[model samples]
Target: MFKFNETSPRKCWLIGHRGAMGHAPENTLASFICGQKLGADMLECDIHLSKDKKCVVMHDESVERTTNGHGQIRNLTSSKIKKLDAGSWYSKKYVGERALLLEELLDWIKEQKSCLGRALGLAIEIKNEPIRYLDIEKVAIEIVKKKKMESRIIFISFDHGVVKRAKSLEPNIPTGILYREPLADPFKRAKELGADAIFPRRHLITKSLVQNAHKHKLFVVAWTVNEVKEMKKIFTIGTDAIATNFPDRLNRVLSNAVKR
Candidate 1:
């Protein structure tokens, strides 16, 4: 897995927020590939169980937002979800793109690694909010284990319990706590949750939060920062990673920052 180097600001990974949502539809294979082509070091996506208990990629429990289909993800089987056009809502060029199963993505990543001689990281966000997927952590982690891609993954979730469940199931895979509200001693709480990192909403990030997290040997990744100015500001705060929809833009900013 590509990790951050404290001495090199440019090594702070660009985690593609929903697979470079600014360029392609969120959470589809097309989006993930676009992120990689645009210079993202890690592809971040959300996962939920299908009616048949297969792990599928999509950010919501419902497919309506990013798909040309209707119904809750858990109510639909994997085969049914696979037929849904997951990219048309974003652009006509991506009309035929379908939602992919987790295994399919893992296989693609493996292929990419062989072809490029480098591992591309994946941050699978466990979508256990508002509704829970039964045994999602075990199922997802089991799939990663089957593919032997544990080292390249970092599981994250707003529901800290779900993230904790991931740790209990697969101690080898690193986990992170996702929070919208600022926590008291963010690094300490993340460690309490058995997480190796903390993912804070961009507004919740402060210099002290990054400093304290680094002090505890925990890393901070700020999320959904799109504007160039905001990206530069977050970069200046010493975060280990920045999750963004416009990874291409973030790449340009980081490149310029490096030159200076």
Candidate 2:
């Protein structure tokens, strides 16, 4: 449902990595709000299933890194996870910010889009590795459809099975594959997984790689690009999208690039 702008000079998307993680706590509402205010074309967030089977916004399988709590997210219920202080670790000024439910985040996005008079895209990365959540793909798809947000979001995963499963469940939904290593033929692999896009780590992207992906009709979105120089390099390489921890910085880069 998320379409790339063909007419733009760069023909690249500026996505907020973990909702402007450089400005606010990752995966929190504050960070997402900051990204939206900074004019991010899209917001990228990670998802995990709680012990109670609710979809929760978190990048890690455990809360140790991002929150004041310690434990596997799958071991905790939504109520317990919501009670933890998700922002203090990043800054005391954001002392009371809590992790958001996927539904809550979607609602916030919807509200922001209405007020901003523009559509905001979302990249939802499902965290499934080592230990897979039962039916997470199905549940997440159901939630997105219920929110009527199927058109505004795309599913991405490091797991090929997850990407394939998501596409199988909903043929119309767009899916992307996330990989860090150099693949022999990324386009072929992505096509095998039924992915419309491929998200490679910044270092793995090359001009030939982008060209090949584009040749196969697959969008190439580089992940977690933060520095100005690195952003410029990726832009010059012609990636279809740049995912960054600082959406404001990416916006400035895009603006300057367009002017030049």
Candidate 3:
């Protein structure tokens, strides 16, 4: 397991948000591979249960935005979802990339680790909310356990119940709450829900917020920050990690900062 507690103040983690979405199609295997190749310390992706109950990798509940197919993810069977063109919308270079099953991605990650000789972290966001998919958390947990990547994976969600359920099912797996607006006592809210971390929108992150989270033994991971200036600011404020659409850009900023 990648230990968030062991992170140094100066060394913040650069997480690939939706597998370097700025570079490749979001939530596809190609994008995740691009993120790893670009030196991301961690990668983040969204998961939703298909009609047939298989875990599918996609950020949107609907496939219209990211794929050649249209309709809610839960309404489509894994066979139908797998046949959609998931990459052409992004670029011709990624044309044949299809939506990946969660298990497929996990297997690929394990192979990558063996080749790299290091463990890579993954933040999986459960997208079952407003219309809950029954036992999605349990299914996801079982998959992670089967892969023996429990320590390398962290579960996060905008739904408080989902976060709570994840912790309840597997207390050892790190869970987090994702919020966009400013919350009163964010750390306290997260702690009360049994979350180990708080994932806030980039602009919502402040030095005081990071300090407060650390004070409560909760880590702060800011999301979707792609600009060099914003990356530098978040780094200065000392977030535990910055989730970005461009891991390469963040890596460059970190390298320059180190040189300076």
Candidate 4:
């Protein structure tokens, strides 16, 4: 259901995880902007709805790690969340950065995609559970639909239940299954969830696993691959994309190697 841009190369796509997190504060607008400038094909981010049902961009359940504020993101209003300095804790240069609403991020992506003449997409990881939040799937889907980005948005979640719920809400929207451990059959799990993609840790992507996942018509994307040697292994394993913090390194590697 998730179609990549026609202009994208056949080789592994390089997505900037948490918006080139290695270069800037993770999950902040500054980081996302910098990643886009640094040649990221897709910007990977986590999304959670605020108390007022506004989609907010963040990585952690708690704000204390990345922002000046402390508490659950859902408990805070847009105005209250905006007031916290999200970047200063990471570096002084990023001191004034604040949490970006999903709408704001989508606006920035629209402008960037137009300016760059490329198909920029969002790999949104849903961080809420229905048990924890009343209607996370409904709110998340509403925002993406409102932005008209359902075509470009890939909904991913570590929680399989959430992924299933998303698919139920909008069967047309593409979804991905995120995993940290080696499942007995990742392919089966993905198929069960109706996922278009299977996102797993770098070490878990074996050659056989890739082949099996692709056989099921699931795009396989390995996460946080930053080293060149490791990158090569993933390529050998045949992933559809590699989520990395160093897009520049991946670009340089590709530039050096000319396919025979």
Structural similarity to truth (TM-score) of each candidate: 0.95, 0.95, 0.95, 0.92
**Which of the two candidates, 2 or 4, achieves a greater TM-score against the reference?**
2
What stretches of model 4 exceed 4 Å from their correct place? 1-10, 114-117, 129-131, 258-260
- Give model 2's TM-score versus the native structure: 0.95
lDDT of 3 by residue, 150-258 (tens): 9888999998789999999999999999998988878778888899999999989999999989999998999989889999999989888899999888888877776
Q: Give the alpha-carbon lDDT of every model.
A: 0.86, 0.87, 0.87, 0.80
Residue 114 CA error for candidate 1 (Å)? Answer: 12
The order by descending lDDT is 3, 2, 1, 4
Model 2, position 198, has a per-residue lDDT of 95
Model 3 CA deviation exceeding 4 Å by range: 8-10, 113-117
Question: What tens-digit string does per-residue lDDT give for candidate 2 at 1-260?
Answer: 24742434435678888998999999999999898888687899999999999999999999999999999989999999999999999999889899998988999887665112458878999989866898898999998899998878899999889999999998777899999888888899999998999999999999999888888998889998999999999999889889999888888888888777
lDDT: worst 10-residue window of model 1: 109-118
Which residue pairs clash in candidate 4? none
Q: Give the TM-score of candidate 3.
A: 0.95
Residues 1-260 of candidate 4 have per-residue lDDT tens digits of 12632223536666889998989998888888878777677889988878887778888876789999988878888789888999999989999998988888887776665113566778888886532666777888888888888877788998888899999999988899998988988888888988888999998988988888777788889998999989877876667888888877766655444353
lDDT of 3 at 159: 88
